[model samples]
Target: MEDERLYAWGNPWFRWSVVSFVVLTVLSFLVGFVVLPSVQRDYTAGGIWASICRAAGLPANWGAGTATDKAGPLSTSVVLAPAMALPGSSDAVGRGATIALQQCSMCHGVQGMSEANAPNLAGQYPEVVIKQLEDYKHGHRIHSFMEALSSNLSDRDIADIAAYYDSVPKARTAPARYSESSAPALVRVGDPLRNIAPCIGCHGGTDHKLGAP
Candidate 1:
């Protein structure tokens, strides 16, 4: 009876079950702690996975290049000039509105709400708008679409468009608490091992890059 009980304890089913459990645990640990973090750290064009994908016949432009790669420095000094003399000025607003409708509405949406693939532009700082437009017009920026579109725009046209977008009211939402989730980790304290910078370090709020405003 004791021998039978020992045999039951060491049954093939139990042995296989333990083996399967161990295998699954090891796979999960490797995928979660090792593979996932590596992928996140090296998701850029020069990353390991990017190179592998390219070698396997995937397209090369999987990730976006840096801002420097896309455009040159906006200006030596930051300009705080107001986009428009008066937001309520009907003539300037009307001309800007017309220009936006004709030239910018498709990707940015009516009144600059943005679309599926584009960013919202409504209520953005007028100076930011002017800088971007100027960059697009000059060879500083490298977006094919924006380069072609902005190439023909005069300086006055850019100012008028900036005025219109700045005049629009910004959409507001209740402030979210960051402590409740892990989303703030990258924004607050980036992974030093990966050499990732904090998002808020360069983006405006507590800190900002020069000429960003």
Candidate 2:
């Protein structure tokens, strides 16, 4: 007696199943990558290769051989150095005070604490000030007023102003409304899946990263 339950490539049913699977896969590939991409109006500009890449989740420019452009008008150009952070001499502080009183007191306040919407420069890091002023002067930061003011300032003048601000005492503030336990995940642990670093890593709680104000 012959056994009848075993299925193998020799069997007609098994051979048909294999053929159907291959045919379906080829049809799916053609419809998804070729047929659909051919009909898209936007992809027509780049031609069939771009369309195929778009359908297959590749960058549209991958087929065009173009490099990515990242330059922008307001892109920051200032690089922070430890030397910029060093405290200035009495002469520099005196000069900076005179300049602040003459030019900056309207917005920044006499003591570097702002009563208006302007930022408080009191007790700010000297390097932060140097970087910001340099950015304004070089057109890296776009502010009509700041650019005009910074443009007139020499490197020595900028350093003196930063030193004067650094010499001022910071304004005292009340305790924070939120506690460590109430801090948001983004502030404390950060989003690991997105590769974002915790705010405290740069802004200072336990440790400070260089050039972060």
Candidate 3:
């Protein structure tokens, strides 16, 4: 009689375990299918997914984990102002400054100074600076300078930086003047041009777009 009772109890427990296992398998699978993609997408969008992944014991290897991630288990959209960097700029500035620093400082000089490769921007007009930055950010401007610089910046950040640039004065650099008489051997075939390219091409338009030579 004890054996019979034990058999009955054991059989039921075994069947329950099987059912639970199946259910868990199906649940994990369904969760994988239904939630991973969106969650991965959210993970790309920012921090919320990262928070959830940590909470759920999911790895946030970011790019290295499951192709889709755990799906809809995470993800939340946020309506953010145009992230910018200028203090008191549009909501965008909040997310924009970091990107600017990441990209702009090479030729333009850090903190708005201009290296020889580019022009000084501090003394430029706010409107002109704003326009150029927009041109870069929007692709209207075609130089590698603008294209690469603006590709990732949002409009607001561009404007904020432009405003920042507008607040400063152009740095003082010696003017380049051509002197044919100064050259010991000025030959037409192997000679610097009698007149150097016009400065007007660049600084001449201090209040306008710096045109190319």
lDDT (Cα, tens digit) per residue for candidate 3, span 97-144: 454456665755665565454666555555555566666556665677
What is the C-alpha lDDT profile of model 2 across 99-165, one tens digit per residue?
9898889977899766665677888889989989999899887788889888999999999999999
Candidate 1 lands at a TM-score of 0.51
lDDT of 1 by residue, 80-175 (tens): 565334453667668888999999999887977764456577787777787788887886767799899999999888888888888887657544
Ordered list by lDDT, greatest first: 2, 1, 3
| Superposed model 1: Cα runs more than 4 Å off | 1-88, 189-197, 200-213
* Model 1 alpha-carbon miss at residue 98, Å: 0.7
Q: How much is 99 displaced in model 2, in angstroms?
A: 1.1
**Top candidate when judged by TM-score against the true structure:** 2
lDDT of each: 0.69, 0.79, 0.54
Model 3 regions lying over 4 Å from their true place = 1-100, 173-213
Q: Estimate each model's TM-score.
A: 0.51, 0.60, 0.37
Name the best candidate (by lDDT). Answer: 2
Report the candidate with higher lDDT, 1 versus 2.
2
Worst 10 residues of 3 by lDDT: 73-82
